[model samples]
Target: MKDQTIEDWSREDLKNQWLCWIDTIDPKVSLKEGDSVVFPKKRIVVQAEMTPLVKSIFARWERLSPSERFSAWEQLKEATKEAMKDVLPSCIQCGECCRKGSPVLRVEDLELLRTEKIPWSALYTIRSGEPVTSHDKGEVFFLVDERIKFREKEGSRECLFLDSTSSLCTIYEDRPLECRAQACWDQSGYLELENQPYLTRRDLFSHIEVLWDIIEAHRSRCGFERLYGLVKKLKESTAQREAEEIASKIIDLTSYESHFRSFMAEQLNIPFDILDLVFGRPLERLLELFGYRIRIEKDTKFIEIITQEGPFHEEA
Candidate 1:
């Protein structure tokens, strides 16, 4: 009778008969050791593969006194109620998605920029081949194409347009195309994002002759491809003099890039902070993407490349 009473609980049983608080756990897998879950009368240990749970040993459970069964039913009722409370019908206006990552702009948002509803300072460019973190993959990879994205608030990754106190979007009426399409409760819209064309830096500024000329010149001198090649040269140089020469070239490029951004901003009345839209990230951060770290001393700057052996310093 003891052996015959135990049986594997079906997922349907969890939903209907068992009322097993199936909301939090994956019902597809059977419960066993190492899995801890609140059952009707107990906290059961479960491991799906090895020791499948004897979750429906009805005869053994019936051995409990009437008071114990009453207490167990109360526990199950409360757990189910707690789990059901978090299902939201609509957005809570918490700005969690905006805080985690600002929406990537698309061609549709161009009108917003023209109207100055989304100010220029609130945007930044991710240049072609720049290293960017992928939230889906949890790894860094080079961006295949250039993109214009919203800038984040200072000292945090929250969207620049977010009003922190009330968790409201500052430009909700003229929010970016991606912002308008997103519905966290629904997943259907996000797949469409993958197929949409992103807005580009050239799309925004290439029409202006003077600004475009300077931007083109900067990309030629300080682009990720050129910088990464320099890093490779620095690492492979066998002689100290050759390594020093490579470092010097990198230093010259960095100096020239800095002067370029400052001068262009002043000439065009662009905010200094928004220069990333004009010229990708600063050379220092670009170098970091190439496996190099930089530090400054009294008069000298040091660039260190990390390798399999370890990092070795180079004076620039």
Candidate 2:
């Protein structure tokens, strides 16, 4: 095949060239290129550094748009992960990973939830399409599918399961698949595991017809995707008149969510948190995740978007 100039090549073509290039690098096993992580296979500790060829390809990546960069990164991760069927590394009881982020639940972990005494307060849902930190990258991106994650301790990112003093998992015997699969030394297993089917609200609650329908309706109405777009508009709208209109829509949506959460908590006699296992974290909390700070006035009916820098004002 004749080589097309890089600018003329499609992302897929670039990705293919990448696969072919990496395939020729060395016969030894390694996870993927980019991140400086080593994979121990056959006693071959392949030092993962950017070779000249790898650097050339990454230089091409520098020219890509943000969306294109993410797409290419995903494609590369998927393609390169299949080669890394690594030996699982044993844990040394360091809680650093747990302190960094909570494990995302996988389908294999569902049985634990069904049989165990883990409370709803301990877990929260990440709605499909919600922006969340990627388990592998730590970069915030919209999820392609919904996930349930164990909540962190109050005011800390440490996993609720991690015992800080002992550096042990409180639920060591019955940890989620993500936790079981994770190895800071060799993320190949974790990376491969990430592509597998994961638990969703539907998987847990779909059996109850009335409950499922209500959850679906609530997700459709109060989803973070809509709020994210509105907040983005709130940030970018240059016109005061248009900004006011956008802020009003934001407040109206917040009101609907507040009332629904209150009504559901009251009617079901379940803590408002139980609903978070289905619909996702409350809107106020999610707004902060999306990079907006929320404050309620005396009325307590609407959220005021506040930040150290510029924030949207309802009056203006």
lDDT of 1 by residue, 55-94 (tens): 3333334554556554544554444444333334344455
Positional deviation of residue 231's Cα in model 1 after best superposition, in angstroms? 2.9
- Clash pairs detected, candidate 1: 32-46, 32-47, 33-46, 33-47
Quote the lDDT for 259 in model 2. 86
With candidate 2 superimposed using the best TM-score fit, by how many Å does residue 298's alpha carbon deviate from the native? 3.4
> Highest TM-score, which number?
2
lDDT of 2 by residue, 1-316 (tens): 3766555566556656655655654444444475445333211212111234334445667577767765755555443444343423465556766887787777787778778756667888877767666666556666777778888788788898899887788888888878887776667778787467877887888998877887878888898778888988888889989987887888788778978877876765657666778678777666765456555678654545445352211000
Could you estimate the TM-score for every candidate? 0.64, 0.67
Backbone clash total for model 2 is: 0
**Cα lDDT computed for each candidate against the true fold:** 0.64, 0.66
Model 2 misplaced stretches (Cα beyond 4 Å): 1-89, 300-305, 308-316
Per-residue lDDT of 90 in model 2: 68
